[model samples]
Target: MVELSKARGSYVDPAPARVTVETWARDWLRSQSQLKPTTLVGYESALSKHIIPRWGRRSLSDIGYAEIQHWISDLSKNLAPQTVRNIYAVFSLVFSFAVRDGRLVRNPAEGIQLPRRIKAKRGYLTHAQVHRLADECGDSRTLVLFLAYTGLRWGEAAARRQRQSIPALRSLFMLSV
Candidate 1:
């Protein structure tokens, strides 16, 4: 217990552990004004669909490694590895807030092993394949050829102005022939 001196006398109160996960989560979400709208939506979705349903009512001090591990394992059984990681990330963030507030000694969501994500293999197109794609695209052939030859991503290609890209494409065509 910590003591505080009042005007009349001293008062002692035990360390705080009464805050529930739901309460802390709400406060944490409300505090995230700098987050993007889409990111905020994702965090809210994860809390409502996963974390809140299972652990919302539990007191901050009552949650521990075992409980968190069990919850993650259960989620992994049905959800994709990335989805599981995202949901766990939300839980970890809320618990971290509790720890920072002195409601807990450590984050219970720390150090848990999660499912590994598998990356798909990328395929490269040959000259023949690029020619065929350009032929099929007809009027958009220049765009297709530019993408294949320059390796610019969709967003970068879309943002390119006609005057800027035409010279570059002509230079590339000169080099290729």
Candidate 2:
């Protein structure tokens, strides 16, 4: 039995059995120095807004698959399916760290079924529709036209500097004229 447990990576130190979910989650968040600022914010939000509330006082070993799954179902009543998934992701990450750090023999939060994510149908504007919107923007007509023809996302385009984009805009203007 010892050999089988060792082979399955189920052998762990008992010291972490005393650590609560909130304590470990904070430690995990602090260790994530390489993550983007926005991603860190999302993790913190998921922890504070969802994961920590129910699991905070519970020790790592006290969290079970059934409880986690039931919590997800309850969260789906008021939150989007994607939001629930995000919350679960943070919770799961905390447990995974505990396993890797030898705090737990195995994660009890594994193998739970998550709600299916529903994708929205994408719509595209016609050329005339794009032109009408550009005309409506007046001063920002070129920006609208650039967005329509280029595949750049709003965030990517918003980060552009006028100095860096004038060359591209000049060519676009040449074609429009």
The global C-alpha lDDT for each of the candidates, from Candidate 1 onward, is 0.83, 0.86
> 75-125, model 2: which lDDT tens digit per residue?
888888898888888888999999889888777878878888989899999
lDDT of 1 by residue, 93-164 (tens): 998887777666678899988889968699998898888888799777777888897789999998989898
Ten contiguous residues with the weakest lDDT in model 2: 168-177
Work out how many backbone clashes candidate 2 has: 0
lDDT of 2 at 67: 87
Residue 13 deviation, candidate 2, in Å?
3.5
Q: How do all models score by TM-score?
A: 0.85, 0.80
- Candidate 2 Cα errors over 4 Å, as ranges: 1-10, 154-177
